[model samples]
Target: MARDRLHEMRGRVAIVGAAESDEVGRLPGKSALMLHAEAAHNALADAGLGAKDVDAVLSTGRQTANDVPEYLGIRPRYLDNTQMGGCSFIAHLQHALCIVEAGVAEVVLITHGESGASRVGMGGGDRFAPDTPPGQFEMPFGIGGPPTRYALAQARHMHEYGTTREQVAEVAVSTRKWAQRNPRALMRDPITVDDVLSSRAIAWPIHLLDCCVVTDGGGALVVTSADRAKDLRRKPVWVLGTGEATCHSIISQMPRFHVWDAAVMAGERAWAMSGAKPSDVDLAMLYDAFTIVPILALEALGFCKPGEGGAFVANGRTAPGGALPMNTNGGGLSYTHTGMYGMFLLVEAVRQLRGECGERQVAGAKTAVCHGTGGILSASATAILSTER
Candidate 1:
């Protein structure tokens, strides 16, 4: 698409409501679908609306798109079940923009619910069949799960960029400081770089502290035209820009180990569409599936030069009261990671823009950049949100 056309779509749609399920982290009682319903109801109630007002619905996970509306009692005109992994919710926001603008849907609700920890109501399937790419190409070689896959990227980054273990540990240490101030954070205890470095190693250079917390939770958002958002219950967080990109699906097939090319592409498009630079952002909600993930994101998203992400995040640069406040909901590292965490990123960004985050709020924050990664560095989505038009 032309640059002018992309720019024209900025702020055409807005998020009027954003919310999480009644409770997050270790909810053994609530099934996956129940979490979805709870979050949908909470989001709609937050928007001062109801199921009857919704004309569209989007969701991911084991449940089908139709299952979401069926459970919520919302017979929608449109439904989307685009599952790209953790970043799916951010991509859904981008799609909702087009749906509302094209008159295909007036009110769209994008939801995410996962029983990642409890495994309640989750279906079982052969993730890697013998004929599948992972099973055929990667799994036979003893490539297990995310920890091992992400460790390869981290090891290469360290080898190439001279990124030190301490620098990577700083990401966890600094993010923990932010989590300490968040009441909703699951692991809010203060942690130092030394603590992170000393934690049990999950994979080489990736400690237990570096990985995101495994929790059960759900979140939802209500998207509509900016005009309609004006009369909503909460202040509208405008969708200034949106972008999505995908690289290789399997970890071994990533374009480059040192840099996230997908994030670079997605961020550039978002920056162009929003007409905003890194300096204009008041806060950033970068997906932190692992400590190294946000370090790579900083460089790819233009917050810093390539190979300088490690140094940039060192010494409390992204912590509370720092120059750049990131992952204010304590991130997936300390907050909650219910399989796909992208929805929580949007929920926190919307709340921060609305000044609803009492303790960890970035004072006078107007613009936020929410970026999410799906799969094993396979997909990326960037969304620029602001309180302004």
Candidate 2:
């Protein structure tokens, strides 16, 4: 008989803890470093382990890897600062698995915090200064921040797929339905397609409600060997599969606007590693920097065929009590988004797999697929997690 190839890192490591900072909404008083420390402390406590037990650290945003260790008062044997925009933590999980599986680190902590709303201690001045590259070219042509830049791609999708404004607005409305159940959600009042359509337009096709909220928050995760995780205080969310890929840095340079090819490649690798199909996923924590993001990701991830994403999510299929409950914490759209929304994706996935979500919880969510999109659809990372080994 022919020998079978091995999935070396599958189910080798598990997330022992996942938590957000003390507060997720606007907190002008808290600095970026403070959020990191608070989230780290909370995650460690969740794992029933202290900072002293951590041998590796991963972080993003203004906080560097070395900065986090010193601030948290831990001396990590290994460290990573893989800041590929928001999806950095997903990539961190992949690296942490390798580190733990190789016996290099017993415990790994990945942290993320950003003062996105208050802009406290953040980089000074406008991100797209007229003197900068994008400013010199894109700005002069009326191209602005992410909403405007990403709108170009969303507009393209509408043209090619015959996707209507109502189809795109459905994403925002359905996601809000989930948000209404979450007490921590920022904009959980509830919204409708008409409300979304009438709302002020940030860009042509992108409305204010269609975009993710800007908030001040942080999140952290604790990863260790699956064996060690089994003995922890909480159920371990196994890292069944992980994949990452990068496309273009700037939105203008992207090869395609309608579909994110990187997500297709990354999601394929993750599903292949887990040996599971899209139907196997109980929940999906897709990055919603904008409504179009998850729509395209759904197609790229094989949840639906390309150009069919509009129909896939039209009637609240991804909303609460639907076929697939997604972003039960309300997601970046209704939940808190501190610039890099990637880490929160993993946090919610872990919580769901642990059976901790109260009202918005999927009835029996055992598996989740968390995906992140960084930059202007430049980078992507996909992770498949499950409760069972």
Predicted model with the maximum lDDT: 1
Error of 2 at 265 (Å): 1.3
Per-candidate Cα RMSD to the true structure, in Å, reads 1.1, 2.4
TM-score of each candidate structure, all chains considered together: 0.98, 0.96
lDDT, each prediction: 0.92, 0.89
- lDDT per residue for candidate 1 within 316-369, as digits (tens), equals 999998999999989999999999999999999999999989989899999999
Candidate 2, residues 54-108: lDDT per residue as tens digits? 9999887765579989999999999999988889899999889888988999899
After TM-score superposition, the amount by which residue 387's alpha carbon in candidate 1 deviates from its true location, in angstroms, is 0.3
